[model samples]
Target: MWTKRYSEILLMTFMSITCTRAESEFELRDVTLHIIPANTVERNSELNLTCEVNVVSRGGNTPDLKISIFKNYNNHNPVYINNTRSNKVTYTIAKAQASHSGIYQCDVSAGNQHLYSSEENINVTGLQTPELRVDKLKVTEGEKVRVTCSAREESGVLEYTFKNGLKVIYKESSSSGVVQRFHSLTSTETAKFSCSYSIHVGNGVLHSSVSNEVHVVVEELKFTAKITILPSTEVIEGDSVYITCDVEGINKNSSVLSLSKGSRLLPRNYSTVVLANDSGVYECRAKVNSAERNAYKNLTVKELFSTPVLTITPAEVFEKESFNVTCRSSKIASERIGHDDVKYFIYRSNKMISSDNGIYKTMAKNETNGNYTCTAQVNNTIKWSQWITFTAKVLVSKPTITVLNEVILNKPFRIECRSDRGSLPISYTLKQNHTTLSHVQVSNPSQKAVFTTSIQSIQQISEFKCEAQNNGVNSAQTSDTLRAQVTVPVGKPNLITVPVEQDITENQQLQFLCGIPEGASSPITFKWYKEKNLSPVYVTTVNFTNAEYTILSVEGSHSGSFYCAALNKAGKEEVSNHVNVSVRMARWKKGLITGVCLMLVTGIVFAFVIRYRAMRVKVASSNGAGIWSVRPPVLDSSEVVDVDEPEEPNVEYTEVLHPQNSDPARVPLRKGTDTVYSEVQSTSPEFHDEF
Candidate 1:
């Protein structure tokens, strides 16, 4: 029995050994391993992977498989892996990073028998947060701008938040993308922004890093302005100019002010004082620190005008005479108005007389003969406050006269005429014995006239008158009457001697004689006077045929009045005439013969000298003499001769003895002889002659 039991144990043991060999061969198959993500993982993100092993046994029992995960198969140790043999095994990672990505493999074996094995890649993809970007790096005040955020994965929606410090100013969420725009934003409103994404990450939302801070600046408001004047369109002197400043987009509290002529800053209180003399453009500017807050207004200062006053002197009325009219005004302060700046316009009889400097004067009279009135304009405004009027009347003047004498029928008489003085274009009329004698016209009126008439006989007294008239009115008149008396003589008297020069030479005698034919008037008286003095020098009465009177050796003291008087039956008549005489030495008698002799001798000698000089010149000219020809001949050709050459020769000289006797019939005299010689010079030498 022992032998038989040993044999069966040997057989069973061989069978068990064969079965174990089959199981080992089955476990020798390769293990198949795989991971959920086979390529990449995001930094600090979960890496979930499931590793599996698929084995097919060759002959014996199924093999146990071992699997592990590593970062790099050539570098780092396994982070997590499953080694137990199952159909497949799962690996869960809380966070996966670059360190969690590597190669993975599973090993399958039965005891010492080898099984199938496989390898896979664990990628560990990275999950990144969405990033925000801005179109502009910075923002200015009142500027419109935008911000954008995006993700490379395109797996979820993104939301953006813009903040200034701790305050959020802008927020936008969009599933399409994270791009937001902010329009018309103040600089203080925008600062920092961040982008958040709605993605699957361990059960919570993820946000990206904030973008670079965006800065914004705010600017001040701007303004514009203009200025204008009211009422009158033109800016004139002395006129009140209403100034208004129009301003837009400027602060209300700020004022518009004018600069004082040359200043750059605004004046105090932003107001300007207007003066009549001040004229220029004025500007108003708003006072603000911002460039946009400043504005300007232009104000123009116009010149002021004044009215002038006109006054007439001498009451404006005159009797055909001249008078003066003057204009006056109160002095204007130069600071308020310039001297001579006011213009004066004088209106008279609808005529305008202009004076820029304002002081005017004029003369008025009846001769002026015009209606006069004046008006003044100040600052372009007409002034009628001052006016004047006047009238002139005809003026009378003195009278003048002209004297006349006439002789008729052996009798002498006088007449007078009158004229008006200082009168123009005067007329005159004369009357005698209640009858008009003559009428005369005069350019200037005068009261004076003269007339003379001879009276031989008269039957009655005669009257004469003269009158001067001006402007159709009688201005002056005068009249005179004279009685006439006559006596007849027996015969005409013979005047043997009449008193001549009453002023006789000293120590000289004067004589007078009278004669009458038979049957003449009985007694005739004669008298003598000097220059018609009050007293006569001599008087006598004679009725004879011859009468004579003589005063011997009369002196200057004997000179007196003289006259002749005849008395007969009717009335006595006297004739008196003035005489004047003077004594002086006679110039011709003083040196009569001596003066004649001197004049005669001087004239003869002058004529002779002139004749001699003219003859010498005639002779020299006839001979064609040069300066050298007039000079004395030299002893030898080399001898010096002091000769002044004549400028030119007289071509048509007369061969007369003297220029004073330069008649063509005269002949030229030789140098040393009184005989006349005539010779004509020919161009041929054969015609030469010596004289």
Candidate 2:
């Protein structure tokens, strides 16, 4: 046994020496181990380990090669041991857990030979929960606010995450603390803030916790001063503009406010009726105690449309000559190059001839002799330009002289000079028998001159002529001569009726006279007619020069229509207005006849009264009683043969006697008589029944 033991030890020692030699040789070969990603990784991340050799020992009598991966956490045991056919090998962990983080090593072997590489370490940290704190709970507008974040516990490495209402604002990793700052705060900036801290423990394992949420509020600044502009910024020309500055949340009496246009300070706190020249950027500043506030705005003012300029080429043109006329806008308006801001119009003789287009062309004619004007406007704007007038000068025609009234030997007459066409301010000269009679100037081309003179003092056959001259610079512009014939003056006569008495007696004579209104002209005769259709029945005699007609005895047959006519030596006859003559008796005569009739009726009534008295006395004496007997008129039997008797007579009677006592049945007797009687009794049955 001893001898066998010794031989086995020697064989093992020799093999060990051989293995050491091979290990030494293999160790000399370049070998390296590398992690696939970075050595440091987040939790739950994949990891890979790779081992490579520069060259495999193929010359030596070596066995098959294999790669083994070892971890420090597993008692330095091999986590991955596999034989490889190539010089390089890789080990992968698809999902790395925290337990996989440790020191790692790879061993390279050929058969029973092996070598270990340098060790690599991977670490994992637990994330710490954070606490957020602020210097203040609220902040003022335009003021700065500060915030801070602190880790809950001491951690390996903490990453502080801060957000403003779910939006990540700041992210930083540090072993210490973190802070956030806000320079300015606005009214709309109201949000909650939270912070969280995290760390990687091992194998990409992440641990985190949220801090208590903190909210911040921003308040609007205090009210100070405000500015208001009246009538808006955009305005047309001549618009009333105003600006007012008011100080609020403070006392106006203690505050000083100033309004300015550019750098020039205004005197008043408010401006009224500002003009376009005042258009510019304005500022309103208010100062109370030491606080100052300012407001600014830009003011714009539009200009009113300007008067258009009219220009006609070839200033003076003759008939049938073509000319061009152009209307242009103001210089300030034309500078607006790209906009259709202005429109033009052309006027001739105060009437619209063209619109929109500024250029106008026309052939010269008598009809185009009047004034021309133009205007411009814009769309949706009330601005308009003033109308400009320019009179167009043109060539004229010859003048014509006319005699206005009849010419007499010793009377004054009128002569008018006229021209068909020309510009205003024309000169006219009147001539008689080729001698200058009078010179006159007419401002209007259409007007003429009237010359009143008598030819009695001058020579006979005084032929009148007139010449017209234009007012233009060209002296050659003149008119042809026009002639007038002279003749004796003859009047158109009118006859008038002479006034006559309205009332006339039947035997009274009536007379009428017809005379000319212009007084009688020599060699003129008058004639009278009874009606319009018949010829003159009476002609003026030697004594009746004015034409008078008389009736010896006026009667109703003389009432008829009458008219008169006057005829001159020139054979021109003129008739007077028709007159109707009516003959009437005097009204006093009718009154006298009515008075005579009244006198006769009075006399008849007096005689009737006398007769009635006589009859009453005779009837009274013939009767013995005081009763009266009214006897009806005796009629023939043929007149009253079948007449019906009336029940009672319509006649009434009075009692002359009265009773002494108050008894109606008894009648008192007269002083001389002893008899007493009642009222008279009627013989008819109707009287008894009525009683």
The most accurate candidate by lDDT is 2
Instruction: Kindly report which residue stretches of model 2 are placed more than 4 angstroms away from their true locations once superposed.
Output: 1-126, 152-160, 167-177, 188-191, 197-207, 217-220, 230-303, 306-691
Best by TM-score: 2
Give the alpha carbon lDDT tens digit for every residue of 552-607 in model 1: 75555554443333333324444433334443223454477679887998788678
Give the TM-score of each candidate: 0.21, 0.26
Q: Could you tell me the lDDT of residue 388 within candidate 1? A: 60
TM match of model 2 to true structure: 0.26
Whole-model lDDT values for every prediction: 0.49, 0.63
Alpha-carbon deviation at 233 in model 1, angstroms: 8.8
